[model samples]
Target: MAAPYLPMSQEEMKKLKWDQCDFIIVSGDAYVDHPSFSGAIIGRVLENEGFRIGIISQPDWRNTKDFKKLGRPYLGWLITAGNIDSMVNHYTAAKKKRSNDAYTAGGKSGRRPDRATLVYAQRCREAYKEPPIIIGGIEASLRRFAHYDYWDDKVRRSILIDAKADLLVYGMGEKTIIALAHELQERRAREEKEQSFAIDLQGLCYVTDTVATLQPQEVITLPSYEEVKESKVAYAKAFRLQEQEQNPYNGKILLQQHQDLFLVQNRPSLPLTTKELDAIYALPFARQPHPSYANQGGVPALEEVEFSLAAQRGCFGGCSFCALTFHQGRIIQSRSDESLVEEAKELVQAPSFKGYIHDVGGPTANFRQQACKKQAKAGACRHRHCLFPEPCKNLEINHDHYLQLLRKLRQIKGVKKVFIRSGLRYDYLMADKKERRRRFLEEICQHHVSGQLKVAPEHASPKVLQYMGKPSIKVYEDFKKEYEETNRKLDKKQYLVPYLMSSHPGATLHEAIEMAEKIRDWKYMPEQVQDFIPTPGSLSTCIYYTGIEPRTMEPVTVPRTPKEKALQRALLQFRKPENYELVYQALCSAERQDLIGPGSKKLISPPMSQKFKNRKLFSDKEGRGKGKGKKRRH
Candidate 1:
């Protein structure tokens, strides 16, 4: 039997023989920190196949010695998307905006250390002259073509070609990794010679080898970036149809402009059973945050602050900016409460324990115990996702299980506090304010809050909300007021933190102005404003570019420029004079001039205060020796 990975140290490396190891998985993120990430689950899946595995987490590929130390491997190298940052920026950027916490270090700007896959491939090239390098996970999978990256805040192309990996494994590699390992082992056993056995390296390539050397096989063709980035209308016509439901290729929008498009045909994204998830969660975890790997001026990975336990997998909310629907699937599956409680027990006892559990939820977390038993009789409900554009009538609102689980978690011995920091779909909690108070009062007060509950009212305008598939602003406001009143009456101090989205489809200047009015009424600066990122596989991305929902056949007014989006985001933040001028101009340009002085006039642009201008000097030095230039249309 292979020795466990506990207390992984250089001393053990000195004792262990390299020949015994079958594969080494190198990641840009920490190993086994959170079960939801590809780094954690993929490693376990490969290990289950009886392959000797070792992990090099948060690897400093820039450091030659660190890369060399992880060199032992009998078969190949498995590179992953990482638990924190995506793969493409393995050499360069960190994703988490200093506030949210899920971040890790990497190369300086314009100096990414080398995508871990590329770096590992180059390292393997130096060591074995020619060894297989397989790259997969979100970073490799999503970046298979030119797509916008939120981390780098730009567009980039296929990671396979860029990273220089031998085989780019797209989609979930639970079975694929095992298959590759088996094939390699079989080749080794048959040839009785490493040199002769190298001929059967199918689905594998090297920088030095040409594609012509391999025998003809049915290789899935990758769609071009241009094909994916086509006009939204063209993309919708090609893949958006109810009749083509099973066509995995349809939901995938490929741009014709990009090279190195990955073929995801026949890829298996197998869902895990509850027991399997429990076992995976039970794996020995190193809970403390590595302060040594900290970046001087970036967000630290949240995994460092508190132990993260994924109580569930997958999301039912089909937000346009999210890719979870395509990747994790829409079905919500959860680990048992017993499993979660056990993890929490260990977390509180961890040397790095901070007395609180950071978060215990999964994609649209409040849906932990929610599932449609109606699916059995209705036969696998055809709905894309339950909470999309709006809640489905069939969505079973069962917070009882989650309530019980939260209660059980509070019972843990060493745990001082447990908070549900993930997005709470407030629409699902439909009890009357009275019933809500009675049932959720104690639940909210004792558990599931970090003094604030986060809810996503993506947009406030009815037209925009309709396109976003979200609830009305009134619905959110009602809940927010009720939550505050309940907390106040109970003598508990708590607030609701709402996440807003800007530049969504159907959001015109008029609608944005109306949203600004709502913000002024609330009188709180929104700390986070998510700019709509049109990721692949989201129904919203289709609407984003096409201005029409493929399924609903509804028209939307989409933001056409980055400048407009920036102006709109500034309006939402609503603090600076430049932002005030932008908002004022946007309203005037859209012919809603009356909204410039906003006082509950359904204005999307807030009124500019004299104080907003007082902060800045209008002298020549402030504006290149001239007063501020006349504002242009947003």
Candidate 2:
């Protein structure tokens, strides 16, 4: 979740007594509301399969007493590799430097501190030393290998080497967790009868067999961190091989050296069915924030609703910088409007309800349903890649359903105002000139928009946008115009807050200057100028290093240095004289001699000499300069 959506205090936590957990699954993520709650869902799945379970709402894993309060599990503790490492991610920034696995920034990558795997492992070891601790999640799934730790700014081995967890379970945990629990309980009983009977903890790796045997678990040949740092592609391949084999925990075949980085070899991630999803929606949501925090500016403002709901899941848009397509796939699944309305109704009755429904959207909100029926009719297409190079051809462009849903939510009693705060694919919404669609948007704004709308254009340069697998700037302009015109007609003064990214791999200093010039023309200073973070499992990561798509094999020029990335980002907000000087100096240092003067067709730079180059951010040595002899006329 973004910083804007941080959780509230204790009092607010009380109003939303939404859950009466049978076995509190203490986790890093806020309970239930996380987009893809695979950890929580798997726990529930096991419970439904006749295993008892409860979730200990976010506990201070740093404290031993906290773990004790969780009490003894009816079965055992199921720890997980958090959905994403809690470390600050800059994968998007790395992608801006190269087109593939060729260049990774040294300082910006690593495992996040909030990752449940590390935090929970430490807590379990200290507090509940007896019941088994099982780890699984994104943190443990993808990087379960010897890889680099961006936070510490050094290369490190597998997570197991760091977390010291008893058992590291990988991939999905639905069937695996249930089996482990049953084995533990059964083993305890068998010991009483025979005094020597043991249980084999299947689908996991544990340090000790207190409930089973006294023998040591065998080891296997695993990739070293040095080997992985040398070649990420090879590491990905090595893990993929392990993932294909069955019986992940059978002796030495199991790779356990860096269990944290080791990709789970066996258990498959189970996709949820419609019924299963409905059950999740039906689960109680304790939407309360702590009260003391609320009064002392500790809770999220009243304008902020205690919880957010995901109306849909998965995105078909294969933006190179996004991980949704790889992790969740391009398929879009959704909850029915009836379910959403029910959830909204429940939200209103809460004691903390402010009457305003903050947001009801997910993964490009207006895409309340999947892509067109044509694609569904043909089944999953084998085109291998999206055609848009940005928004795939199969991306279903329909806002009619979404429009209806929003209108219904607004009509709910006690709901003061329903807003759509999630990112809206502006291009998708404006593709057709259908008067009905346009008018529907007009009405939605009149009813739902909270004075501002966020749409991501990413970059203005055609080449950069294309390289980013995004729609052209003209498409973004079209959407902006339509949005403005719609609001104008309704007398609603809301404005489109377009999201932009600087330092994408394809953007050159000149292109960046052009983007900066575009910002000046728009007369809008953005609140957040996003630096790209190229996360793992995204098409952009390959492009960040290789400068070409593996499938098409096209030639690309990646921006591969710190100075280039910094200059490009600064251009997005070049207002101060200092900013201009910094950008001008940066351009000169990069040997971009032609952009120094006031008469250039592009954005200009004031001249600075070689004496300033050593100064931080800007200096004379990197200053704008006249060409070696004469300025080349464009």
Candidate 3:
């Protein structure tokens, strides 16, 4: 049987024969004890180490009463914005408030405050002033230093300052948390004064007022917060340095001043070892939402990943629009095949377990291990990406290990089918010169794919793809050919669900139309198209805000106008009845009236009546540019 849920109330703690929780975890999400939730992982990890942990999920941030419900923690209070940044959770890419939060019970929104980590930490301070307030998870991790805040439209100081947090743990912080917990435990056991924080561990950062006193061997002091806030050039430079020091093996310390205090970030923690990864996964997670959520229709987020197996963590795909490199780092860390297979066995036995396993993959499914053997020692190159314009010569592009792991999963008695549902880097897969790619493709076609597979071919425009740090469209075309060939050989009718996006930084209406033309050739109507959201810490966001690429400090064309953005998005889903007006406006605005008539090259028919003449998200001058739609036969 699975272990009991961690105590959320004092009565439950009393049953555990505990006077107080050693750590009280305050999260913006409802307390779900699944590993997919950050609070659950940290709680379980702490529990495995014999720490008395309690949870206060989605507490009212209005006052300290709800924050004090769990009583004081013996070691510290763990504050997180939950599985996702609370702002992103509550708001849409268009800055409109969303009505429901998947991570919340009953799928409710407004349960947590904006900038949740800050509010939670402040509440903890009000509840009890003594113990440390440690903020983490994606929100705190990404904002450990001064970062661009899309909602506010300006750079904000490190979270530690705004939250008044004692220490900030960034990145995937399991190793750092464990080490810090042990240190805090020693002093508490001996009944000594709260010791000063010593944040030498990788994947950790803390605030300091004295920069000269710190060990300066490899410290990189960035432009001050004042500078970054006032100057775009300084902001871009700071971001570049922050992105470069993500490697654990060879990374240096980064410091950026805010007020008198400086945010000192140590190098990231090394990716967990296979043995360590196995042990963490082996922990007895109840693998379900807390029993309290049962009457409230349960946690909706659990439905997606509860039955799935996370075989690995981290990514090397290096998409500029992605934030994984900063948070999970570039090194790929996989659990042992034995560990995942064992998890599959337990997963099948769950009362809700069906015959199918949802997924057995991570950030990038095809990446099972490090991009290359040398990455562990030397770290990723400072200015280069493993896969971008093209796959690097040093990239190790074999999928044999992943194939073997999949076969092992497929052999599990209760599992009728195992699917590879995670996002994959097809370019990396195609770069494998060895015959291993063929065998792997064949295996995936015959056994792994669940009818259709999804891959991101973000755009068709070479200029936009380059700015987005994606490979050329030709790479996707070549892979599509190979995928079709494999399906033909296997006699399978599976299709590739190519994920397309619109209005990414550097995307114009021309690019959006180009992508629509490509989609038309496939004779598929996309049910949904992702609008490029400028989240914190991404190079794409930098371009969106400053109109300059952070790395190169070169000006970039950004689609910031709401009407234009909507038009670009509509272009991708031209078949939708609601989008017809927008598509027509966009084509006409671009002076491509030829694409509006009833012809082979047309995207939408001419106005059905005088009623269509008034639509105006676009005008004659809206999308005017030198380039018009170039007729091309595919």
Best by lDDT: 3
Q: Give the per-residue Cα lDDT of candidate 3 at 588.
A: 79
Residue 587, model 3, lDDT: 83
Compared with the true structure, model 3 gives a TM-score of 0.95
For candidate 1, lDDT tens digit of each residue in 260-284? 3342223233455688678766765
Q: Each candidate: how many clashes?
A: 27, 71, 0
Predicted model with the maximum TM-score: 3
Report how far residue 111 has shifted in candidate 2, in Å.
Answer: 15
> How does candidate 2 fare on TM-score?
0.71
Winner on TM-score between 1 and 3 is 3
Instruction: Report the candidate with higher TM-score, 2 versus 3.
Output: 3
Residue 318 lDDT in candidate 1: 60
Candidate with better TM-score, 1 vs 2: 1
Model 2, range 82-125, lDDT digits (tens) per residue?
Answer: 44544432234443222211111112222123445677778866
Best-to-worst TM-score order: 3, 1, 2
> Could you give candidate 3's per-residue lDDT for residues 429-449 as a string of tens digits?
889864877888899999988
RMSD of every prediction: 6.6, 9.1, 3.8
